[model samples]
Target: MTMTVRDLRPDVRADAEGFSDTRRLALPYMLSTPESVVHTLTHAHPDAHFGQLIAEEEGEIVGTAQISVAHDSPEPGQGSANIYVRPDRTRRGAGSLLLRTAEERLAALGVRKLFAWVLDEPDNRAFAERRGFRASRSAYFLRLDLAAGMLPPRQDPPAGVELRTGADFADDPRPMFELDAVTSSDEPSDIAVEFTDYEAWLEETWQHPLLNLGLTSVAVVDGRPAAFSAAYTDGGTRYATAMTGTAREFRGRGLAKLAKNDSLHRARAAGYTEAFTGNDTGNGPMIAINKWFGYEVCATEVRYVRELG
Candidate 1:
């Protein structure tokens, strides 16, 4: 069977299903649904010009790529293409074909540099480098078996600290957004991102399909949100911490850790068997916190960059 590549058609249900399926098989740690996929494509910032590309094997979708420009970044010409082939269907040149097409699009858009994330495996890394992509930053995907792992005992709210769910702030989530912006700025990453646009945050983040506001834990200090652990579930047993951080002034008090503990405990009580999250390899503080919670690195992914000539 001949392998072919083409743009994904969101108007067709099968295409969306195939695309979502390929992604789930390739990256189990992340969650994706057809609705969310379509939403992302249609509601994406105009400047992003995102492309949902799929690789077909005899008309059957076998691989997928999320190609988009870093439109919100202060600098231009930065684009990203995250490509993945189904775990069972490899070595058919799908990745190579997708990368070739994506690089062409980026170059045509005057993108001077391209970034891609390849799984941290011997074969995956070799493939990226073989295509002129040099390895850059890396992140660890951590997993916790909630059903069997012994979790920290949940405690009552400590003195002067109150616990609240993200839903409580539904009428006004600007505070949560403010806290997220502050913590995200301090996160380790190659691209410096600023989340200053509150309306954009509400549209893309607060309404995300996987966000489990009920399970999200926020630590309140004197009446203001000081720390939080955002939750995202796969509409099943898999639960992931989207982000966990403390306010700059509230650091060192262990409030972030406390919030995450509360979230995890509630997740386990809710019958989530698997929990997953990713942290930059250089984020020692977050790595230590995950270790303390008995999470282990299940996989890794490395960023690869290519200079567009």
Candidate 2:
């Protein structure tokens, strides 16, 4: 059977569903939904020049490529193209075809630095190396058996602080946004990012299909959101933390730990069975927090970079 790479069409129902389905199975730790897929296709920053591509085999979608530029970063020509094939559908020509097509699109946009994330398996690493990419930093996927593990008991906030759900700020989420901006910039990563557009945040993150406002816990200090653990669910037993961070001024206060514990407790109480999150290897403090919650490292992936000539 011949494999071919092609653009993913948002208007086609089956194609969108297949793309989302493939991603969900290949990268279970990351939350992906049909609605969120469409939201990403339409609302992504214009400067990013994002492309959603799929690799098809004998009429079945087997792999996907999410290619985009790091438009908001201070550096120019920074591009990212992450490829994921369905676990049971490897060894086909899909991965190569997807990479080639993505590189061509990125080259046309004058991309100079191309980055990709490949699973830390031997074959995946070899594939990336053979294609002129070198490994950089790596991160682990942590999972907690919410249904069976004994989560640490939730703690009361110190004076001048309180625990609250993300839903509490339904009328005004700008405070949460401000906290997110501060935390995101400080996250350990290869590419530096800045999030200043409120409207973009509303379209991309706030309106995402899996963001569970009821379960996302936030720490409030002096009536201002200072730390938070964002939640995403597939309307089932699986729950994941999209992000957890503390504002710069409040780093030493332990508000992030408080929010994450509260969120995990809520998820387990709400009948969730599994909880997933990713942590960069260099982030000792965040890794320790996940360890405290009994999350074991299930998988790891390395970021590879290629400088386009």
Candidate 3:
């Protein structure tokens, strides 16, 4: 009958399950699993000071928070605490408790500026504003129904280009990582991040439970990875494009579109029913690519920032 906020215990299966359940219920557009939840918490960078919090109400986990510092960013003292509460369990004090605890923890770690993503709904926006957070940039969540076959027809790679899956580079994924780093840097984000540590990438990204390497398509130029479409599946009907980008030198060649189309076709063939992705509102190129593939905007979320002394 009382709601309490505490750290998530990955060792306890119920805790992981409940945390994942609450996340999926709160934000179905993104993929989340118990294994991914544990992996992220365990493998985060030391500088990140990552923490996962769960709000339990009489034995049910109804809210969750992902708290972490932007360690990879060139700047210091920037942190994030994204809190999500179950829609059916609204009006409870779970969000407030989680936010207070997360802010305190990050502040203790010397974080100065805090950011959070709030669903672009009246109640959610009010909650963030009430906490002294101001609305910032926004992103749109898009979805594609694979069963409908609305995806663009698969096309052959251009001359001297080869299409491959992320699994093809499993023996050595450094190439894929290199391509990812280059492309990720070009993405539109308030926090600038650099993927400089290969081992950390392997531990935190390449080994993530939801990443389906077999379905992640890559565009190779003369045997080098030039573009990629990263895929993450929920081990079920849902499939999502985590990131899709082309190297700077490979832009304007349509390499990203090639990789993503191949990946989506393969995913549909593999029986995935729903596909999801998100793009910042300012990212016109990526949004155009998603539209070309029949993806429609389903939901939106606005980033909110607050200063912490």
Candidate 2 lDDT, 5-36, residue by residue in tens: 89889888898899999998998887777877
Name the top TM-score candidate: 3
Whole-model lDDT, model 2: 0.92
Mark the regions of model 1 whose C-alpha exceeds 4 Å error after superposition.
none
* Deviation from native of the Cα of residue 97 in model 3, angstroms: 0.4
Cα-based TM-score, every candidate: 0.96, 0.98, 0.99
lDDT winner: 3
Clashing pairs in 3: none
As a whole number from 0 to 100, the lDDT of residue 306 in candidate 3 is 96
**Candidate 2 residue runs with Cα over 4 Å from true position:** none
Ranking by lDDT: 3, 2, 1
Count: clashes, candidate 3: 0
TM-score of 3: 0.99
Could you arrange the candidates by TM-score from highest to lowest? 3, 2, 1
Candidate 2 vs candidate 3, lDDT winner: 3
Please report the TM-score between candidate 1 and the true structure.
Answer: 0.96
User: Lowest summed-lDDT stretch of 10 residues in model 3?
Assistant: 148-157
Q: Estimate, for each residue in 157-178, the C-alpha lDDT of model 1 and write its tens digit.
A: 7899999999999999999999
User: Poorest 10 consecutive residues of model 1 by lDDT?
Assistant: 39-48
